[model samples]
Target: MTTLGNMKVHEITRDYGIDGLSITERNIPSLSARQVLVRLDAVSLNYRDLLIIKGIGRWRPPAGRVPLSDGVGTIVETGSEVQQLTLNDRVAGLFFPNWKEGAVTTEKTHDPLGGPTRDGVLQEYVMFEEDQVVKVPSYLTPAEAATLPCAALTAWNALIEKGKIHPGKTVLIQGTGGVALFAAQFSLISGAQVILLSSSDEKLERARELGISQLINYKKTVNWEKAVLDMTGGKGVDHIVEIVGGNNVDRSISALAPNGLISQIGVIDGLKGEIEISKLMPKEGMVQGVQVGSREMFLRMNQAITLTQLHPVVHKIYPLSAIKEALTELEQGNHYGKICISAERNQ
Candidate 1:
């Protein structure tokens, strides 16, 4: 392996049926044409990274590499033909390095930051293409900016791109994780009413303080879909950010108004379950799959964030050496925002 100065990485790796990744060292990756070497400032954890570490679903990367989907870093070196990035530029890599446009799909979304596809940024240094990096907002810290690529972009894509959630529209966000919180904020910023659902009443109370119009404690209100209907005067919400797939889809579909949209993003509870298509037929509603957004969509989302002065909620951060613990905390789902990792400390 070729060394580009000094480099070390703390990443999650899984082989075969084994789980719980470990850290390892390798020669620093060299930059290719139109690529840049990035010195990682911080890396945020997404549920996708957790899925990859657990070797679940379709997120598995290639064999023998660090695992992660998104990270923020400063450009240290650039390839000869790379005109888009420069040294010291504050930027975050995209969810799909090669995906530049259009709706994301299985073939296009095959390669992500961490997992088996490519090396993740949980390490001290990583290499990326010029286009794969999106500039961070001046107001946000690297840790905060790091959360944008996967979770925020997914929410943005779900609302702005697919659901077209607009002013006067009503949107329902499930849970308190990065995506749901962003959905709530985006809805508020777009002049729409937001209903946040959570198992924890305490977190729901905090969301209320943030101006969330309504909070549904799903644990207390198991049939929360009916509550949504009541809140909307029996019209149902215009859009629902569906994080819990499987059995929950039926409820989400039931909560949609006429021509309503359901941005299907996750399956935290479990993916294997049935949905009643007839529930959607009468309303003529739509259930769209939301992968993270494109680079162009990311730029648009950045502009929206800037215009609204929106900030990503960061619950806690850990040093790079404590990646495992950070991941454990994320899996426990107690945080109201994102879990981050500081890369430089692992050296």
Candidate 2:
């Protein structure tokens, strides 16, 4: 185990922007009676991080806030009252610390990590209440494990928890970003066929290498909904991981089979638009907005990942010092999977 010492942390010191993020040195935090200190190895980027950085959404952080939700680390110290966690245990922080299990509630959703509410894990070391962390899968690298708490968990909640994807079902995944790719991987693990849509043929080809043969170039096929219907023999898909918001919702509804599920995970397209209620009414389709997930769901997903040896697709890794560059890469939206930040010096 590495020796613990003073830590360096990135804080949003100025107005909302990548430039506002500044790294500062601070003393290692004191452990509370129920808190455990962890040495973060890697942290993964999410679209939500970008939104928080830009102050684009409701969850904007105050100045000097640490800014990332998902990270994997090793426990270096534990308080006297901490019984569930021990030194050297590998774990990741939960996105929602209070919501350990069960259905989502207003109170549980209020204090998510990495935003305006609570400080996130974008530091070399962090402290968490013993119940706020989960063990990482043994087979995963820190980078892979870091990707699980947000993007991967969101996909798991949307597909496995809500969509109930299974054999013979067709899942429509939009874009080749983190959540979409995770959804595709989880769907394949559940024996479902995946039809991945991307603007770039190059990106789609890369996805094909991951066993997704059914590809739709949305740029080539302007009416991609028609293409989806054609591919399903006009029956449409069983589930749509709807990342694009706005009028894309209408198209997603159009591309669903009878009683299909649409897991609305992102709002890249825009926030508000006319929903074609007349179109959505006949299919009896269901649309559910996905927040990341509960800690219980994260534990269940980790068990499956460990059992299947499912690896997260990390497109690129940047040093913690290059966080601005990493956020730029994420904003460009060209990556095929999760963009990660490694705090490991050797990496």
Candidate 3:
């Protein structure tokens, strides 16, 4: 067991570029009555984290905040009032601590970790209420487990929870990022056909190794929606995991079958766009924006992951000190899957 003491953390010391982040020291936080102290082993980067770090989004945190929402750690100490978890239990912090189950509401969605609200898990040690963390899948390393809290859960919610994807249903996944790949994986797990679109042919080929036969290179075919229509025999896909938020939504609408669902999860291609209402209206399709997911959904997803023995695609790993380089890599958008930060190196 590692000795617990003061911890080193990277904080957004200013609202600027990656250079705004500073590594500093802080005393390990004391646990409250229902809280537990955890030693973070790994943290994963998300597009949202990049937006938050750059102060580019609506949910920008104040300066001096620790920024990141996905991480896994082992409990080193538990408060007397905590009963659900024990020392040495491995768990990942929830993005939205208040969202335990059922439908999301304003109150439940208010406190997102490592953002405009709460502190994230980029530090070596963190204090969270026992309920704010979920057990990591036993088969996964802490780095792999760190990818689940955000990317994996968002894909699961979009495809299984709201999209109601099933066998024979066709799911269209945009890009080959963390969520997109997980969407493909989970869709395949449900016996659904996955048609993944990426600008890079190499990424498309990588998706093929994961059992995705239908791949589309958007760079090669600009009107990829037509390709989708042609591939589905002019019917279009049942679900489209829409990651590109610009005018691409209009294209997604064009590629949807009747009563199909478009799980709008990202805006990587530019935030503002004009939706073709005329095209969307005729299909009677639904476009639902998905937040990561609730704790209940995370638990359910973990159960499925354990049963399937699914492994997340880890594109790269970096030490905590290489946060700027990691963020730069994410900004370039060249990686095929999740990028992780290992706190063990810092320790």
Candidate 4:
């Protein structure tokens, strides 16, 4: 196995100036008895990673390597106790970093890789517990599967697990971020009608080509909630993937039909705020927070992905050296979907 050390990573020094990210060489991580060492082929950035860089997320790495929660790689070595995985297994890191199976808890969610507390996958090599890694589908390359750990799993949990949406149900996905985009694709593959909302009509139009039944340009229609209501002929959507959390909560709640579920997946709109819960009371609407997903969820998502050959929509790719530029593009919201970093290309 390659003992990768003195590797450069995008270190976030401060919150205000993203340019504060400096490339620094650090030691390659070592594997535990139950761990596997992977040479990461690709990594994808998520909105949560941005929040951590911006100093808004719950936790932050005190020192050491910069953090990234999701990446895909080939295992180069397996620990003595690791039986399920072997060298050369194409795998993605678990979202929780530590949580392996069963139910999720505050303890399980405490330290996510690439979040505040854990060092992320931005480095060339990473060590993972064999149980915390899930093999990617054979249909997906490293770059495509790299986007799955966060966006795909969250979308799956939101629509299928929390919302319990079926074929005939109408699903509404807000924003064109990675999660929403994945939700749109997953909804379509499930034979559900997907209404995609985005500020840019051009992006919405692009989603149309991917089996999106309805598109709402929220910028053009200021009251997009009314448009959502109008589309369902006042019945509203059966499932709403709510990415922007704050004041938009009531609107998402309002746009749901009776007993309709809202997957509160993110706080991209406003992090600290209050929502009017009374509106949801009338419809008995349920809003469940989705913090990515579990390993089991990833397995389920992969099965669905392989069955449909559903690949993630990658908007742009950046070589590893241009990570800062790629992150800047993401911060500016220039890309429509996931931004991938090719590690081997730059290596």
Candidate 5:
């Protein structure tokens, strides 16, 4: 919050990967009119963060870019022109700050937070317009709130906002990652039945504690679609959160009920794959691509979280100095929830 003092930020250098990361001190930037200074308290890692860190494909940021897409912070200093926000208000930045409402566009999707074009929250302080950030639920801690910007909102947009997932609907979620678990939780909240798929039995058991009764081990039962069809009495599922892309989508299509919706959220398997249109046509299956949501959607999600007292599942929290370890843990794909970075001076 003090422009007079030097602040430490983790930067991406030419080397790339964990070795490429360097922490250096620079002058804390001054805020302009309409921009409020935020002291970021926490950061959460996403699969996309791993891609950015590894310098994969289009995810490769320019040299000296700061990486991370999700964070929760407090307004340490408010600009003179800023309104509707007071000092000490806790908030999370929107992944797509320009996509404030309704319908997406090329312009709205540009300059995403913590992506190649913009600096992220790994630093001690962030600056944004009051409109670019939304107040988090009062009951949620910084780490829990940190997970909302990307993973939580993506799941919400996929299930609640677009799919209208509720009672009488059966949702099949793939994996035990942040978005998948959040989708399972939201599905349960809306009175929908969930069938979750994971390679690990341990993760499946953990999901059971979240009230998910139907679990499938994709590793053991390779043809899990048949299991889904059998469970639904040959009716298939009403929704599928397609986290595993490539050929796995075809399998999801095989397990869809008539008019079922599949929210395409990830590409862990492969980026490009062909879909068998004949299968989808018979079921009228809809595959909707989901992006992290807007400010309006984030606010609505915060309200629902407040009402339900829902907590984001955090697998682990590492000190800011231990970010490389956090990223490595996320890369290993062993964690069941969001991985976070503590921004405390001593952490």
Candidate 6:
């Protein structure tokens, strides 16, 4: 097996802000039985990383924690008892490693990577249990594979696995970020109509390039809900990818068709939200919060990706040294797709 003597890790300081982020050195850890070592190639940023870095609410972590969730890399070494995974395998760690399959439980959601609960894969090397990581679609680049763990999988769990949406369904997609784009692509494959909402006409035009023609610039159209209803013949949409949380949720409910499902997966507006019960009750609308997904779900998503050759939209790739700049870009929110951090020297 090859050896990495020491590796650089981005860590959080007591300040818990961008200023608190720093680079540090640590010796490579030894592997135990049933464990394998991955030389992480890239890590993709999500809005959740910002929440954790800024110490928002329950996302606050102790000083010296690594903060990142989505990563993809090649296995470099395997422990004696590690049978399922072998060297040179390309894999990404599960967001919720303990939850392999089945429904959500408090215990399953209790601890997640890149948070206060456990250290994330911001470093060059990460060790995982044999089953904690899953192979990704071979057709995707490392950066694209890195985007799957959270955003992409959350989209799949919401619209496909849980929503069970099919052809002829009208899906209202919010924003143009990672989750939104993934939802849009998945909706296209399922033959569902997508009415994407964005404040910028430029981003909406970009979505149109992806073959999603129905678009609305919320900045110009103050009440895009009416547009959604109008496009659906006053019946409202069948599904809503509610990436904008908080009071906007009520707006989503207003645009829901009878028995429609709205997947609450983002907190761009705010963490706290209130819905109009009267509007939802009459429509029989349902709001389901998606917490990523299990390893089993990841496997299934990979299969679909491989079959369709659907690539995750990647806006830009920054080297590890520019993590702060990447995070700042994410805060500015102009990017149309996922922002990624690559550990490769050439990047």
Best by lDDT: 6
Higher lDDT: candidate 4 or 6? Answer: 6
After superposing candidate 1, which stretches have Cα over 4 Å from the reference?
A: 1-3, 11-19, 60-63, 345-347
TM-score of each: 0.94, 0.97, 0.97, 0.94, 0.98, 0.98
In Å, residue 132's CA in model 6 sits off its true spot by 0.6
Better of 4 and 5 by TM-score: 5
Assess candidate 6 and give its TM-score to the true structure: 0.98
Candidate 4 lDDT at 24 equals 77
How much does each candidate deviate from the true structure in C-alpha RMSD? 2.2, 1.9, 1.8, 1.9, 1.3, 1.4
**What stretches of model 4 exceed 4 Å from their correct place?**
1-6, 14-16, 57-59, 345-347
Predicted structure 1: lDDT: 0.83
Off by over 4 Å in 3: 1-3, 345-347
List per-prediction Cα lDDT, in the order shown: 0.83, 0.91, 0.91, 0.83, 0.91, 0.92
Candidate that beats the other on TM-score, 1 or 6, i.e. the better one: 6
Writing each residue's lDDT as its tens digit, candidate 2 over 1-347 gives 22466788888875778888888898888888899999999999999898888877686778888899999999989998988889999999999988899999988888998979888999888999999999999889889999999999999999999888999999999999999999999999999999999999999998998899999999999999999999999999999999998889999999999999999888888888678888777989899999889999999999999899999999999988788999999998889899999895654
| Candidate 1: tens digits of C-alpha lDDT, residues 99-122 | 788867677677766756677777
List candidate 5 stretches off by more than 4 Å. Answer: 1-4
Which candidate order results from sorting by TM-score in descending order?
5, 6, 3, 2, 4, 1
lDDT of 4: 0.83
Off by over 4 Å in 6: 1-3
